[model samples]
Target: MGYVLRVRMASFFAGAATASCIGLSVLYKDYKTPHESISLQAKAFHDSLDTRISTLESLRQSEAPQLPQTTTD
Candidate 1:
C-alpha cells in the first residue's frame, strides 16, 4: 500500500540521518589534537626562522667592501 511505502521511506531517511551524525561524532573525536602539541610545533618553527634570519643578517654585516679599480676605456 501507499501508506506502507511512505513509512519505509521515512524510516530509511531517519536511519541515514542517525548514521551520519554518529559518523561525524566519531570523526571529530578521533581527529582532535591537543593545543600543546600545536603550540610546541609553532614555537619550534619560529625559533628556526629567527636563527636563519640572524645568520643572514650577520653575513650581510660582515661582507667585504668593494674596492675602486682602474678600468680600460
Candidate 2:
C-alpha cells in the first residue's frame, strides 16, 4: 500500500509538471505573435510619419516668406 501510494504521487507530480511546461510554451508562443505584429505596425507607422514630416518640411521651405535686406554704405 505504501509503494502504490508513492507511485501515484510521483505520477501525479509528473503529469502536473508536464502540463505546466506545455502551458508555458503555449503562452510564450502566443506572446511572440502579438509582439511581432505590434513591432511591424509600429515600424510602418514610423515610416509614414517620417514621410509626412519630410513632405511638410519641403512645403514649408517652398512657401516661406522672404524679407528684404537694406544695404548700408
Candidate 3:
C-alpha cells in the first residue's frame, strides 16, 4: 500500500509538471508576438493618440485668429 501511494504521488507530480511546462510554453509563444500583448496594443494606441493630438494642436494653432495691436496717440 505504501509503495502504491508513493507511485501515485510521483505520477501526480509528473503530470502537474508536464502541464505546467506546456502552459508556460504556450504563454511564451503567445507573448513572443508583438501584437498579442495588451501592453503592446495599448502602447501603439497611445502613440497614435499622441500623434493625432499633436496634429490637431498644430492645426488649431495655425487656424487661430491673431489680434491686431492699436497704437495710442
lDDT of 1 at 3: 100
State TM-scores per candidate.
0.47, 0.83, 0.51
lDDT of 1 at 52: 100
- In terms of TM-score, how similar is model 1 to the real structure? 0.47
- Candidate 1 lDDT over 1-73, as tens digits, reads 9999999999999999999999999887666655567888999999999999999998988896767998999
Candidate 3 Cα misplacement greater than 4 A, ranges: 1-36, 71-73
Candidate 3, residues 1-69, lDDT tens digits: the string is: 999999999999999999999999998888777556777789999999999999999999999999898
Residue 69's lDDT in candidate 2: 89
Better of 1 and 2 by lDDT: 2
Clash tally, candidates in order:
0, 0, 0
Residue-wise lDDT of candidate 2 within 20-42, one digit each (tens)?
A: 99999999999999999999999
lDDT of each: 0.90, 0.99, 0.93
The weakest ten consecutive residues by lDDT in model 3 span 31-40
| Candidate 2 root-mean-square deviation in Å | 1.6
Off by over 4 Å in 1: 34-73
Pairs with steric clashes in candidate 2: none
Candidate whose lDDT is highest:
2
